[model samples]
Target chain A: MLIYDLFKMALRSLIANTMRTFLTALGMIIGVASVISMISIGEGARQQTLSTISKFGTNIITVKPGRKKTRHVSSDSVQTLLLSDADAIEEHVSLIIGAAAQVYRPAQLKFGNKNTNTTVRGTGRKYAKLANFTLDSGRYFTKEEIISARRVAVIGATVVKNLFPDINPIGQELKVDGNNYLVIGITEAKGALSWYDPDDQIFIPVTTAQKRLFGMSYVQSIDIQADKIEDLEQIKKEIDTFLRIRHGIREGEESDFHVQNSSQWLNSWGDAAKTFTYLLGGIAGISLLVGGIGIMNIMLVSITERTREIGIRIAIGAKKSEIMEQFLIESVLISFIGGGIGIMLGILISRTVSEIGGWETIVSTQSILLAFGFSVAVGIFFGFYPARKAANLNPIDALRYE
Target chain B: MGQLYLNLSSESVMIEVKELSKTYQLGKVDVHAMVDVTFRIDAGEFVAVMGPSGSGKSTLMNLLGCLDLPSSGSYFLEKFDIRSLSPNQLAEVRNKRIGFVFQNFNLLPRASALENVELPLLYGRIQNSHQIARDSLERVGLADRAMHRPNELSGGERQRVAIARAIVNNPAIVLADEPTGNLDTRTGDEIMNVFSSLNDEGATIILVTHERDVASRARRIIQMKDGRMHQDILNEGLIA
Candidate 1:
């Protein structure tokens, strides 16, 4: 039989029973919709994480003091990194742009009777630039302020809201650890992510924090900025070598400091997001499989119901292959139409999630194609047996089937 | 709509059977549906097969229609040996050479009378099938009811639609099994008349029926009894 005529016959039969056709296709619709929306949500989360991490600057590297090793026994963190180490890396490293040594401690701040406990970080003049911090209103502390050990501070958005509400925080006097300091700047808000809130801290001159507040000379950590992203690895190696020599750690021995870059964070988070996408897709794939089985079940019942019809076709000289082709076309048409509607439904679902649920969702072309292709494959896989059964029916027996 | 060929010459045999036999496995018992049945039918001859129920006339119809293979016998349609043809080749023979009408008027219930008639042509991969199917419906005097579904048609009209479907591809022979079995006497006579006129137009027709009145309409009669041919006679004398 001609393929066009076969398709017309199949379409006519399906149209003859519209309600059953829709019900049979419903399984594929739901399966493909869920797969698309799940993948979209996963991709959205990954993009959001990468963007947030990139906010810390991809070329920036952080070095924190690791546990001190004595006789191969690891102990508590030791303050091996100092101001000289930061300065030496900045001056001696070939690809280095600048470095900032930071000392952080929880301190109580009092502003005219109202008080709030906040973390106070003391660093050099280049700290704000290296950390991607922008001033909201006032200027950052100058180099002169850091060298002279002036009691100047930069307040964050959260601290301003808590202690300096109804008043301009810049140029105001804030008392830190019972010592008075002048607030010179207020940084813009950076939303809280995970366990840390960047907008809840205060920045002060490192000289003042070491000499007057903590009375300690060793710094807690160093943040280094490389000129270009491509130079990050080379810069890290240079810093590692310089820091180890400066701390006098012997060769082939564990360094007392740990070096980390933004790329590492990106790689780990990217891997996690990909795994999450696969997990959701796998679960949705099961639903698609079940949908295919549902199609097979319905097809079996349809063939049984149309046994006389099959007999009539066979009597009229229809080949067994033609009978098989007719039923197969019916099933494939159901799934193909279902997949199309499912793509639209899935896009709508993801859009609604992003709008109402306040979570990012990205619907990619690859996911839509994958879901559509899978649904069609399910149709064929499940449809084959029933079609073959119908084709193999004995014409005389089928004609006599009441 | 075109002139059908008159193969009235005795040398052009349309169907030939020699020692045709068929047995069915009914649990542990073997039932012989047809035993050593032999017959010959020429083209353009109207023949009626008459038998009581369980007399193996239905088995003969099946074998003649190329629907069922014989257990141990030889059957030929035209020049092709029926036993030697593959299932696909047999299907082609059935498509182009033989047409069938059933007792129950087994038209596809969902299709209109027009589509039903178009079925054989569709299977034969014939072009201009719609026009040809309409022409066949006109031949059965059902052209006005072409768009009506089977359920909407009366028993007589539905049988006419089945006849239209049978002749749509213009096959070499038309085999009908109890074509008027489900109709009232008046409607049955009407269906028989339609067959008589088609046979007059040089279309070969073979009918199976138990009714003597129906058998009288044919020019030849073959009677079966208990899986064997009891008698074969020319009904022209009775018509005279």
Candidate 2:
């Protein structure tokens, strides 16, 4: 028989048992949807992390005090890093444009009747150039302000929203750590870096934060910038070598501090995100496998139920391969339709997640095609056995079947 | 149409079988279904092979229909020796040269009468099947019931639709096994009349049944007893 005729015949049979057909296809629908949505979520998170890393400037390296792998990793216990180390790196490392050290501590702020707890980041004037933090209003604190330990602050967008909703945050006096400081500047919104909201921090002079607020402390982290993008790895190696010598760690002994470049941070994050994506996709893939098994089971039952019809077809001269093709086509049609519906459902779910759940999700065309192609392959792979069974039936026995 | 099945020496013969035997294993013991049965059917002959149940008549029908291969046999459809043909070739012969009408009609319950008739033509690679199916349905006196499924038609009408499907491919033979067994006396007689008319138009038909009355309608009767043929004769004395 012609392929067109075979397709029509298979369609007619599938339509005969509407409920069974629907239930069988539903398995595939759910399987593909979960897979698509899970993959989209993973892709969205990876892209968000990558963009954030880029936004912070890829050439920058962060130096944190102490060996982080040791039990004592908290900055309160690690006092090996200092402002002198930052100055030494800038003087010795020729590739470095700026090596800025910062004292970071979370503190409470009060403005009139309103109050909010946010991070206090204390850094030098070059932090603006090094960290790529652009200003929205007032200028960054100058060198004179750092030397005098002036109690002046730059507020981020989130701090402004929470502490001063209506009034201009810049030029306003805000109490930081129970000490009133003039808010001299407001920075543009940097959005979220994963779970950390970058716009929720208040920037202050490093000397003021160390002497007045977080007293008697070595800086928490050193933020360094390379003169050119190509000099990043070279700068990181120089800082590692210099820090090891300055901290007096011998050869083969672990250094007292870690010098981490931006891309390394991205790579670690990327690895974790990749694992998460695979885990989600794998769980969803199990359900899709179940769906293919469902198709196989239904195809077997359908073939057995339609034995007489097959017999009639065989009697009238349908070849064994033709009978096989018809049943296989029916299964493929089921999965193909299910795959289509799943794609639409996946897209809908992805959009709803980003809109309602506020979760990041991106459905790539590659992922859509993969899910669709997998469903098709599943149908064919599972559909073959039962169809072959149908094709192998003896016409006489089938005709005589009740 | 191009005399593809013809041989000048035996141009009149449509089917020839020799020393045909079939054995089935009923559990462990062998059951001889047919024993050295042999028959020849010329073109345009209306013949019936009559026997009681389990007397090997149905086995003969199955073998003749090419639905089952014999344990040992040389069966020929026109000039093509079926023993030499491949399984695919056998399917082709069944599609293009032979037709079947079952006792239960065996019409696909989901399809219309026209679709049922179009089935053999489809397998035969006949073009313009919709028109041809309609023509075949009209020939079976089912012109108005072309769109009706088998359940919508009466028993005799259903059998007539089966006959239309049987002849739709213009086969060399039409095999009907107990074609009127499911119908009433009147319906059965009507079905037999349709067969007689088809035979009058020079169509070869072989009807299998236990009923002497049904076999009486055929121009020739071949009787079977046990697993062997008892009689092969014309309706020379039975007519009128």
Candidate 3:
């Protein structure tokens, strides 16, 4: 028989029972829609994370003091990083743009009667450039202030809002640990960095903080900036070697400090996001397999129902290939129609989720095409057995079927 | 008796059967449906096989129509040996040469009268199927009811649609198995009248019936019993 005639027959048979056809197609529709929507959400989240990481300075590196162990079996080791180590790194590393040593402590800031407990950071002027900090008002302390150990401070926007609400905070006097200090600047409102709220802290000179509040000459960590991102590894090695020599570490012993680049942290985050998305897509793909099985079941029932019709066509001279082709075409048409509907529904679902859940969603053209092609493949793969069964039926016995 | 020719000439028989038998394996037992049945039917002969239930009349018709294979036989249809043809080749022979009319009319319920008549032509390699199907329906006096489905037509009208479908491909023979078994006596008579006109136009026809009046419509009657032929009689007088 001609292909057109077979197609016409298939279409007529499907149209004769519209409700059953629609119900069968609905399974595939839901399967494709869920897969597309979940993948879109995952892709959107991954892109957002990468963009956020890139916004931070890519050439920045941080060094922290490692836990010290006592050689003489003492319970505690008093080994601490100091300002001299920061000086050593600045003098020795060729690729280092600037370095700043920091000492952090919690203190209460009192301006007149209003007081708020906030974290205090003690560092030099170079700390502002290394950490990508910008001032919104006034200016940071000059080199003269650091050398003289002047009691000058730079407040964050959140600290100014809480302690000096309605008052100009620049050049105002604020008491810290019972000592009076003048606030010289206010930093810009920078949102959370690494889960720490950068907008709620105060900055002061490391020399003055160590002399007055901390009463120690030691620092907790050092921040460094590289002139070019490509020189970051060389700069870290130079700093490690300088620190090891300054602390008198032997060749075969582990160092008491660790150097970490921003790229390492970003890589960890990116890897976690990729795994999450793959897991989501894998779970959704199982539903697609189930949907394909549903299609196969319905097609088997259809073949059984039309056994006599198949016999009549075969008796009238239809070839086996022609019979197979007719059934294959019917299955493909069903899945194609279902896939088209699924794409429309998936887009709508993604939009709804983005609006309601406040999650970012991006639907790519490639994903839509991939989903449609997969649905077609599923139809052919799952529809093959039933089509073969229909094609191989004996005409004499089929005609005699009740 | 007519002279039977062995060569493929004008005088050769269109269908020749010799010692044809069919046995069905019913579970563990084998039932002989047609035992050593022999017959020859020439072109343009209106013949009937008459018998009671379980008398192998339908079995004989099935073998003649190429719908079933015989257990042991040498049956020649035209010039080809029926036993030697494959299933697909047999289907082709049935499509191009033989037309069948079943007792229940066997009209596809979902199709219109015109589409039903167009079915056999669709199976054939014929162009202009619509025109030929319309002409066949006109021949059966159902031109006005061409668009009505089987359920919408009366019993006499449905039987006429079946006749139209049977002759639509212009096959060499028309085989009817109890063509009027489900219809009333009057409708059955009307269907027989349609067969009479079709045979008058030189189409060979074979019918299976148990009624004496129905068998008398044919020019020859072969009576069967216990899977074997009992008598062969000629009707010297034709029914009007």
Q: State which candidate has the highest lDDT.
A: 1
Write one digit per residue (lDDT tens) for candidate 1, span B121-162. Answer: 988888999999999999999999999999999999999999
Proportion of true contacts reproduced by candidate 3: 0.36
lDDT for each candidate structure: 0.90, 0.89, 0.83
lDDT of 1 at B102: 96
Worst 10 residues of 3 chain A by lDDT: A70-79
> What digit string (tens of lDDT, one per residue) describes model 2 on residues B1-240?
223343436679988887899999999999998999888899999999998888899999888888888899777788787767778888898898888999988999999999999988877778999999999888889999999999999999999999999988888999999999999999999999999999999999999998989999898999998889889989875564
| lDDT at position A118, candidate 3 | 91
Per-residue lDDT over A1-402 for candidate 2, one digit per residue giving the tens place of the 0 to 100 score:
888988898899889899998899998999899899999988898888878767777778999886533444433447889988988888888777888989988999999999999999999888877877899999899999999999999999999999999999878899997899999999988788757888899999999999999995689889899878788888889889988888777787677788888877778988898888888888989989999999999999998999999999899888888889999999998999889999999999999999998888999998899899999999999999999999999999899889
Residue B214's lDDT in candidate 3 = 91
Winner on TM-score (1 vs 3): 1
Q: Note the chain A TM-score of all models in turn.
A: 0.91, 0.92, 0.84
lDDT of 2 at A73: 47
Model 3 docking grade = acceptable
Interface RMSD of each: 0.8, 0.9, 2.2
Error of 2 at A352 (Å): 2.4
lDDT winner, 2 or 3? 2
TM-score of model 1 (CA atoms): 0.92
Sort all candidates by TM-score, best to worst: 2, 1, 3
Off by over 4 Å in 2: A67-77, A227-231, A245-254, B1-8, B238-240
